[model samples]
Target: MTKRRIFMAGAMSGLLLPSIHAQTGTNTRIRNLRVLCGFPPGGATDAVSRRVSDKLQGSYADVSLVDNRPGAAGRIAIDELKRSKPDGSTMLLTPAAVITLFPHIYEGINYKTDDFTPTSTACQVQFGFGVGPGVPSSVTDINSYLRWAKANSGAASYGSPATGSLPHILGVLLANQSRVALNHIPYKGSAPGMSDLLGGQVPAFSGLLGDWLPHIKTGKARLLATSGKERSALTPNVPTFAELGFKDLVMSEWYGFFLPKGATKETANAAADAIAKAVRQKDVIDAFAQLGLEASASTPTELGIRMKEEFRLWETTVQKLGIKIEI
Candidate 1:
């Protein structure tokens, strides 16, 4: 298998730091910058946006805030972003799935990948499949869980942070490959879905590794497998889906920034520079690590390339799955 290049905050600093410059405005500071998050507050997307928003204050703008437009599996924020000004005052920090996977899976999606200009990527996260108390203790690993699900098809259901998300796709892929009857439950965000996972409202869940880490540590959830090319360092004992015989499932999701279409390259560069600087900070890096994300930065051009690559990759995968969703 080919290895994926992992960008680090430190490695990108030398390339991006020199690009940071002051944008011309009142008192040399932009006022009331808003970073939009598609998911509700307290989820991974919101956390990354809030952290970067704090760093953006004083330098990028006089005030920075996270605008939570949570709905329609993150499409709400995308629509809101399309209507936002292209002056760099507003930015969207969202999962790559909304750009890469949505167009493939969703019907009547109003926004296109080109509707927004790529700014910078905040971080990348791996997905994990976890089981809660609702699952039988006898089901320990992916194979056992699949067997249990097959035996109890009526009760076989999994929750994902949102519909048509990478986690949701991963769940569907697993069921298709294993020939198991597993239904999917979509949530507004990880917090509410995770609550049900611990409380046994759903027997299984596929979501970001961060969503399950705390519960797993507290013995409230059991991680079955991760979706990555290699084993996750945080859960070394937990095998990856590839290691568990699902080679096609190796994938990861990233949180990236984007400005609405019609934004100038200079404006995009300024936002990118601020985001690169912010994501590389020691505090930001440590905080992201706790959330099972690898904090990193990228040039706007680099982000655009990565986004296209991901879009193509998900296009092929979604085509193979033959899944199209409405809304």
Candidate 2:
């Protein structure tokens, strides 16, 4: 064959090889999606991840599994995701605390918000402050609670899920704003923290609404105020911090999905579309509602923007509070 013909044939072969291989099923089917959650099973993060995964499974027949890699305040799973292939098959489902707050609070975190491609924000969950029944204050709102707490002269202590978790930060912020001196206590997990609160071991605890809802209903603990901009639908009578004149006290934990960094924009968009479809399902919404979590999804761009805003807010708060740790 002529030299030009030989070169042209080789170029055509190069183009057709991949197509032939793909058609032969040598390419992995875009099924068997794996989702990573950085919390143990039965935790709020785990519950939300599973709910989203089930919805995704229903919408996309390919999704087959959801994996939990809970450790180091989500850093372990996040690091694993960073080292994963930049393919669409592996997804990380986690709360905003890991991405936006961990890097600022912990000294040795290896993954940052930029390390992953955001797919979609699945939901925003509100937090509530619950005081053990032992506290003398029968206050129902933040203002009254703060006033009573101040009168107690730092005797009131609050428990948080972990040392540098979102609830810890919220407790610190609440003390700073309300001029209430509170001794901060940290627990290994929300379950333990809620246990102490229910048993009247701690005067108060601040964490996810889901963790505190049962205790609230059982009259073991009283809901002081929600940390969101508005009252939660599950607890409409509970006033928000903003309504009580603490506008800056807003805090809501949120979860989002991410693919490894450098994934193609097409792949990211496809994942986001899939999650959005999943979020719209009635069963998914109802399931999350049962956990006191609002079911919603945002575009990848919106997730990015929200992450940036949250990072800035947490950075400032951490610096202001002088919270430094080596987790």
Candidate 3:
């Protein structure tokens, strides 16, 4: 049979026949495909995981599932992934920080960057600093808040998702650039930290732009500044740290897909192709936008390059900041 006939047969049956071994023509049927997520069911990570799983299920002929294994800020789920066989049956959909930053911060983590293969980035979201009533009504933007922090005791305090997380790093950078003494309060996650920020328990909150955008719209919180090269599309009125002169402060969090390190080239390529196709769909893009996420995709090789670059960048940043976590 011609190769075209084989390809057509595989497509019709929802199977990838001999994708990695065209010469041998060993047909591989993908089954019980699991997309593992490290966070709880309702949070951002789980949400993104389920979305991708839904899209892939529609595209693939096999059953796809999103399995949440929440514990230790994704370490448990990652450990589960590390133990799984690298046969393209299991994949992880998680935040880039989990792969890029966690190793440097946690002293006793179970996984390393070498344990997985990069597929594609699913979406990107910006970071921001939010303010609540503890900050005086006169304070509007980052510069004014900096000035106010210098005089007020609790005004300069800020909360982040966790120690050594990107938001924590942002606060550290802000202190260094503005030469202000800002207290860094680390929370288990952004939800509770944002809660304090909105309840006046904390004056400032540092986390994703999505976490605070809703409250900002309702007049319940103030987005002092965003952490991106440019203002977020959803909050154009707010200035970015870079535009305000701290160009180094620009950053974004990403959700990305990864397979086990030993997965075959054909497996990785097919996975990347599926995700690239899914994210480009108008409905998927619009859904991501509504969540304040920017939909994006990259080839497996491009994702690998990004992973290596980000691993280097974050490694240096963590070292320079002397950031570490007890657990």
The candidate maximizing TM-score is 3
By the TM-score metric, which is better: model 1 or model 3?
3
lDDT of 1 by residue, 195-222 (tens): 9999999999999998888988989999
Query: Which candidate leads the pack in lDDT?
Result: 1
TM-score of 1: 0.85
For each candidate in turn, the TM-score is 0.85, 0.88, 0.89
Global local distance difference test of model 3: 0.80
Decreasing lDDT order of the candidates: 1, 3, 2
**lDDT score for residue 242 of model 3:** 84
Minimal lDDT window, size 10, model 2: 2-11
Question: Any residue pairs clashing in model 2, and if so which?
Answer: none
If ranked by TM-score, best first, what sequence of candidates would result? Answer: 3, 2, 1
Query: Compared with the true structure, what per-residue lDDT tens digits does model 2 show for residues 72-132?
Result: 7776677667877776767899989889998888877766678989989888899888688
Off by over 4 Å in 2: 1-29
> In candidate 2, residue 251 scores what lDDT?
91
lDDT of 3 at 206: 91
* Candidate 1 Cα errors over 4 Å, as ranges: 1-29
